[model samples]
Structures are given as C-alpha cells and as structure tokens.
Target: MKTILILYYSRHGSVSQMAQYIARGVESVPASEACLRSVPEISEVCEAVADTVPDSGAPYVTLDDLKTCDALALGSPGRFGNMAAPLKYFLEKTSSLWLSGTLMGKPAGVFTSTSSLHGGQESTLLSMMLPLLHHGMIISGLPYTEADLISTQSGGTPYGPSHVSGSDSARPLTDEEKRLCTALGKRLATLAHKL
Candidate 1:
C-alpha cells in the first residue's frame, strides 16, 4: 500500500479537521492509505520543550515518517499569511533529508485554514510548498475539474485545499470546503500511483 503522510499543525482545530477530511480522500483510493501526524507546539523559552507524545489528536511526526512516506499532504493554520512556527520548525529539521533527496519525485500537496475569509490561506499554502519543492517533490493543487473548486465561496483554492473558520474560529467547514479537501487528498493519492 502507498502511504500518504498527512502532516499538519493546527492550533484552532480547523486545520486538523481539514486533515481528517483529506485523509478520507486519500483512503478512498485503492492501495492508498493516510498516515496522520502533527507537530508539537513550539515555545519561545530556550529551555522549554514539548512532550515526546502529544496529549491528543495525531501523534507528533518524526523524520523517519517523512523518509518513508510515499506521498505528503502538508497542512497548517495561517499565521500572518504564513505557516505557523511549529510546522516551520519541524521542516527546518529536514535538512538531512533534503541533502539526501529523500522526498525527490514524490507527489505532495498542501492545505491551510484561516479565521477570516481573506485570511491569507493561499499564501500559507504556498509557503508550505516551498520546502517540499526544494526537496524535489512534485506539487499538486486542486484542479478546476473539481466542481467545488469553481463553486466554493467559503474556502477552496487551485493552490490547494483551504478552510475559512470564521472570526471566533468556531465555524465548521462548509460542504464545499470539505469536498475540496477530500478532492486534493484523492488527487495526491492518484498522482502517487501514476508517478
């Protein structure tokens, strides 16, 4: 079976929800499976450290996961139009994999969630793609062939899947957003088989 690692860092739970939807999409494909993993919160204190295991949600990701996965789906909550610090910190540790080209030629995709409708979701998704591109992974985005990509008014993008969680971050994903997320995951898994 092909393993598509769904790695994400979600603070307000929106992105995490998106990850689950994406995993559903991945698993819908024959011979494809999703591996959901998340990164721990980063602390500003020099000595502060997160626990080895997270209390809830997906387990913390490891470098070995990156090296072993057949494909990748990266997700994050937008922070000032960029990926959150915790996810960035984890990617920085991937230099060893980058040097060895462990992720080269792998099919990958990105996703994000934002509080506002225009809350930099695309930028955040694009930013997450940078490291994967450097690792030589082929990037995939939601194609217009997906009906939701054309009809989605809440959150969905050609760059990838996205969600607009609202000001209080309490809004659940709209039906369109959910479909788009699943579409991206399925697309990635399908591409992995072709590649």
Candidate 2:
C-alpha cells in the first residue's frame, strides 16, 4: 500500500481539521493510505527543546517519515502571510533529505488556515511549497474544476485547501473548505499512484 504523509502544524485546530479531511480523501483511493504527523512548537531560546511527544494532538514528526512516504500533504497556520515557525523550523532540519533527493519526483501539496478571508491563506500555502520545491517534489494544487472553488464563500483556493478562521481563530472548517481539502488529497494520491 502507498502512504501519503499528511504533515501539518495547527495552533487553533482549523488546520488540523483540514488535514483530517484530506486524509479521508487520500484513503478513498483503494491502494493509498494517510499517515498523519505534526511538529512541535519552537522556542525563542536558542537551546530550548520541546518534549519528544506533544502534550496533546499528533506526535512530533521525524525525518524518517518524510523519507518513507510515497507522497506529502503539508499544512500550516498562517503567521503574517507565511508558514508558522514550528513547521519552518522542522523543514530547516531536512537538509539531509534535500541533499539525498529523497523527495524528488514525489507528489506533494500544501494547505493553510488564516485569521481572515484575506489574511494570507494563499500566501502561506505558497510559502510552504517553497521547501517542497527545493526537495524536487512535484507540487499539486486544487484545480478550478473542483466546482467548490467556483462557489465557495469560505476557504478554498487553487493553490490548496484553506480555512478562514475568525480573528480569534475560532471558526471551523466550512463544508467547501473540507471538500477542497479532500480534493487535494485525492488528487495527490491519484498522481502518486500513477507515478
């Protein structure tokens, strides 16, 4: 069976919910499975470290997971139009994979959650794609053909799936957002299977 890693960092739970929806879409393919993982928060202190396991939610991700997955679905909450620091910090440690090209030619996609409709959800998704591009992975995005992209008032972008969490980050993923997340996962899984 092929496995697609649904890796994400969500502070307000919206992004994490998106990840789960994407996983469901991935599993819809008969031969593909989803592996969910997350990164721990970072500290400003240079020498500080997070516990091996998080106090709640998904466990911390490891490089091994990246190397072994057949495909990738990367997600993060938006922080000033970019990916969150914890996820960025984790990606910074993937130089070994970059050098070895472990992710080259793999199918990958990105997602994000934002505090407002225009609060950098698309930018955050694009920013997350930069590292995957460096890894030589083939990036995928939701196409307009998904239908939801044409009518949704909530978070769903051609760049990837997204959620418009309210200013306080209390909003949940809308049905449109959930469908887009699934669409992206299914698209990635199908492409991975073909490749």
Candidate 3:
C-alpha cells in the first residue's frame, strides 16, 4: 500500500483541520493510507527540547516518515504568509534525506490556512514547495478543472488547496475549500500510484 504523509503545523487549528480533510481524501483510495504527523513549536533558545509526543493533535514527525512517504500533503498555518517556524525547523533537518534522494520523484502537494483574503496563502504554499522541489519531488496543484477551484470564494487555489480562517482565526472552512482539499489529496495519491 502507498503511504501519503499528511505533515502539518497548525497554530490556530485551521491547518490541522485541513490536514484531516486531506487524510480523508487519501484514505478514499483503495490501496493507499494516510499517516498524519505534526511538528512541534520551535523555541527561540534553539537548545530547548520538546516532548516526544504532543498532548493532542498528531505526533511529532520523524525523518523516517518523511523518507518513506509515497506522497506528501504538506500543511501549515499562515505565519506572515509562510509556514510556521516549527515546520521550517523540522524541514531543515531533512537535509540528510535530500542527500540520499529519498524523496526523489515522489508526488507532493501543499496547503495553508490564512487569516485574510490577501494573507499570503499562495506565497506560503509556493515557499513550502521550494524544498520539496529541491528534493526532486513532483509538485501538484489543484487545477482550475476542479469545479471548486473556479467557484471558491473562500480559499481554494491553483497552487494548492487553502482556507481563509478570518482575522480571529475562527472561520471554518467553506464547503468548496474542504472539497478542494480532498481533491488535492486524491490527486496526489492517484499520481503516486501512476508513478
């Protein structure tokens, strides 16, 4: 069976919800499964240690998970239009995987949750893709062909699936946003199967 890792870091719960939706999409496939994992908050001290397991939400992600995933659906809460610091810290540790070409040719996609209409969701998604591209993963985005991509007023993008959570970070994902998230996950799993 193919494993699609749904890796994410959510500050206000929006991105984590998106990850669950993406996992639902991944599990919809006949022989594919989703492995949900999350990164911990990064401390400014850099020498600080984190608990091995989070009290709630997904467990901390490991290099083995990243290296073995057949496909990846990355998610993050928009932090100044980029992924959160913890997620970045975790990704920086992947140099060893990059060195071994462990993720080469794997299918991958990105997602984010933003607070405003213009809140850098696309830029965050694009920046997240940079590392995946460097690792030789195939980047996939939601195409306009997806009906929601055309109709969404609340956060779907050609770059990837996104959700607008409002300034208070209280807005739930619209139906279109949820559907698009599922669509992106399914698309990644299907492509991984093909490749």
Candidate 4:
C-alpha cells in the first residue's frame, strides 16, 4: 500500500483534529494509507530538551518517515501568519533529506488552524509549503472545484484546509473545514497513486 505521512504540530488541538480528518481521507483510498505523526514541543529555554516521545497525541516524527512516505500532508497551528516553532524545528532537521532529494517528486499538501477567522491561516499553510518546495516535493492546494472553497464561511482555503478555533481555541472544525481536509488527503493520495 502507498503510505501518506500526515505530520503535524498542534498547540490547542485544532490542528491535530484537522490532521485526523485528513488521515481519514487518505485511508478512504483503497490503495493508500496514512501514517500519522507529530513533533515534540519546543521549550523557551535555549537548552531545554523534550522527551523522545510525546506524552499524548502522535509520536515525534523521524527522518525515516519523510524518506519513506509516498505522499505528505503537513499541518501546524498558525503563529503570526507562519507555522509554529515545533513544526519548523522539525523541518530544520530535514537538511539531510533535502540534500539527498529523498522527497523529490512526492506529492505534498499543507493545513493549519488559527485562533481567529483572520488569524493568518492561509499564510501558515503557505509557510509550511516552503520547506516542502525546497525539498523538491510537488505542492498541492485545494482547487476551486472542491465547491466548499467557494462557500465556506468558517475555514477553508485554496491554499489548504484550515480551522478557525476562536480566541479561546474552543471552536470545533466546521463541516466545510472537515470536508476540505478530507478532500486534501484524498487528493494527495490519488496523486501519489498516479505517480
């Protein structure tokens, strides 16, 4: 079976839920599967180290996951219109993969969650795509054909799927957001199968 790596970092849990929805979409493809993983949180202290395994949620991702995946769906929380530090830190460690061209020609997509409707969700998705681009992966975005993209009032974008978690970070993913997430996963899986 083709494996699609769903890697993400979540703070208040919105991004994590989005990842799960995407994974469901990936697994919907008969010939494809999803490998869900996440990165450990970063500490404010420059020298602090996190546990090798996260206490809850997905295990910390490894370089092997990136090297072996048939496709990739990267997700993260929006931080000042960019990806969160934990996801960025993990990407920084992928220089070896980049040098070896391990992800070259692979299909990839990105997702994000924001605390507010205008809290930079699209920018965060775009920021996450930069590293994938540098790694030579083919980027995929939600096309207008998805229909939800044309009508979503909550959180869906041409860049990728997103959620508006509200200021308290308590808002759940809307039906439109969830459908878009699944669409992205299925889209990536289908593209990976074709490639």
Candidate 5:
C-alpha cells in the first residue's frame, strides 16, 4: 500500500482533528494508507524537553518518515499567519533531505487551523508550502471541483483545507471543512499513485 504521511503540530487539537479527516480520505483510495505523525511542543523557557514519545496523539515525526512516505499532508495551527514553531523546527532539520532530494517530485498538501476567520488561514497554508516547494515536492490544493469550496462557511480553501476554531480553539470541524480535508487527502493519495 502507498503511505501518505500526515505530519502536523496542533496546540488546541483542532488541527489534529483535521488530520484524522484527511487520513480518512487517504484511506478511501485503494492501495493507499495514512501514516500520522506529530511534532512535540517547543518551550519558550530555555528550550523545553520532551519524552521520546508523546503522552497521547501521534508519535513525533522523524526525518525517516519524510524520506519514505509516498506523499505528504502537512498541517499546523496558524500562528500569526504562519505555521507553529514546532512544525517549523522539524522542517528545519530536513536540510539533509533537501540535499538528497528525497522528497523531490512527491505530492504534498497543506492544512491549517485558525482561531478566527481572518486568522491568516490562507497565508499559513502558503507558509507551510514554502518548505515543500523547496524540497521539490509537487504541491496540491483543493480544486473548485470540490463543491465544498463554494459552500463552506467555516473553513476550506483552494490552497488547502482549513478550520476556524474560534478564540477558545474548541470549535469542531464543520461538515464542509471535513469534506474538503478528505478531498485534499484523496487528491494527494491519488496523485502519489499516479506519479
């Protein structure tokens, strides 16, 4: 089976929920599977350390995971119109992968969760795409062909799938948002199979 590695960092769990929906979409494609991984939180107080494994949720991502995946779906909570630091920290370690062109020509998609409707959801998605573009990954986004793009009031973007979690960050994924996430996942997996 082809594996679509979903790597994300979520502070309030909304982005993680989005990842699950994407995973569902990936699994919908025959001969495709989702491999979910997460990055640990970064501490502001003199470099916080974490256990090798998280207490809950997916395990921390490794460079090997990026190297071996057939495709990738990257997600993160929006932070000032950019991705969270933990995910960026992980990506920074991938210079070796970039040099080796390990992810060159692989399919990739991006997703994000924002605290408000104007929380830079689109910009955050673009920010995450920068590194993937650097790796020579084929970036994928939701096409207008997905009806949800026209109807989604909560969170869905042509750049990728997104969610509006509200200031409290407790909002659940809307039906339209969920559908877009799944569609993006299916698109990534299908492209991986073809490419």
Candidate 6:
C-alpha cells in the first residue's frame, strides 16, 4: 500500500482532529494508507528537550518518515499568521532530504487551524507550502468544485482545509471543514497513485 504521511503540529486538539479526517480521506482510496505523525513542542529553554514519544496523539515525525511517504499532508496551528514554531523547527532539519531531492515531484497539501475567523488561515497554509514547494513537491489545493467551498460558513479554503477554533481554541471542526479535509487527503493520495 502507498503511504500518505499526514504530518502536523497541533497545539490544540483542533488540528489533530483535522488530521484524522484527512487520514480517513486517504484511507478511502484503494491501496493507500495514512501515516499520522506529529512534531513535539519547542521550549524556550536552550537546553530543554521533548521526549522521544508524546504522551498522546501521533508520534513525533522522523526524516525517514518524510523520505518514504508517497504523499504528504502538512498541517499546523496558526501562530500569528504563520505555522507554529515546532513544525517549522522540524522542517528546518530536512536539509539532507532537500539536497537529495527526496520529496521532489511528490504530491503534497496543507491544512491549518486558527483561533479566530481572520486568524490568517490561508496565510498559514501558504507558509507550510513554502517549504514543500522548495522541496519540489507538487502542491494541491481544493478546487471550487468541492461544493463545500461555497457553502461553508466555517473554515474551508481553496488553499486547503482549515478550522476556526474559538479564542479558547476549543471549537470542534464544522462538518464542512471535515469534508474539505477529507477531500484534500483523497485528492493528494489519488495524485500520488497517478503520479
């Protein structure tokens, strides 16, 4: 089976929920599987470090995971209109993969969760796409044809699926948001198989 790596950093539970929906979408495609991985939180202390495994949720991502994946769905919580630092920190370590063009020509997509309606969801998704683009991956986004794009009152973007958690960051993803996430996963997986 082809593995579609759903790698993300979720400070709150919302982004994690989105990843699960994306995984469901990936698994819908025949001969495709989803591998969910996450990045650990970064501490301000210079010498502090996170444990090898998280207390809960997906395990931390590894370079090997990125190297072997057939496709990628990158997700992160929006932090001031950009991706969270933990995710960026992880991406910064992939220079070896970049030099070898390990991810070149691979299918990839992005997702994000924001605390407010104007919380830079699109911009955050774009931020995640930057590194993937540099890696030469084929970026994909939801087309307007997805119907939910026009109907959703919550989070749904052509750039990818997004979630608008409340100020407290407790809002669950709306149905439309979930569908869009699934759509992105399926689209990426299908593209991987075709490519």
Candidate 6: where are CA atoms >4 Å away? none
TM-score of each: 0.98, 0.98, 0.98, 0.98, 0.98, 0.98
- For model 3, the superposed segments whose C-alpha errors exceed 4 Å read none
Q: Is candidate 2 or candidate 5 better by lDDT?
A: 5
Measured with C-alpha atoms, the lDDT of residue 124 in candidate 2 is: 93
Residue-level lDDT of model 6, residues 1-195, one tens digit each, is 889999999887999999999999999999999999999988887735599989999999999999999999999999999999999999999999999999999999999999898999999999999999999999999999999999999899999999999999998889999999999999999999999
Clashes of each: 0, 0, 0, 0, 0, 0
What is residue 75's positional error in candidate 5, in angstroms? 0.3
For all candidates in order, the CA lDDT equals: 0.94, 0.93, 0.92, 0.94, 0.95, 0.95
lDDT of 5 by residue, 1-195 (tens): 899999999888999999999999999999999999999888788667578799999999999999899999999999999999999988998999999999999999999999999999999999999999999999999999999999988899999999999999998999999999999889999999999
Model 5 backbone overlap count: 0
Model 3 backbone overlap count: 0
The sequence of per-residue lDDT tens digits that candidate 2 reaches over residues 1-195 is: 889999999888988999999999999999999999999878897846689988988778899999999999999999999999999999999999999999999999999999899998888999999999999999999889999999999898999998999988898888899999999989989999999
Sliding window of 10 residues with minimal summed lDDT for model 1: 41-50
Better of 3 and 5 by lDDT: 5
Local accuracy of candidate 3 as per-residue lDDT tens digits, 111-148: 99999989998999998999999999999998888999
Residue-level lDDT for 83 in candidate 3: 83
In TM-score terms, candidate 5 sits at: 0.98
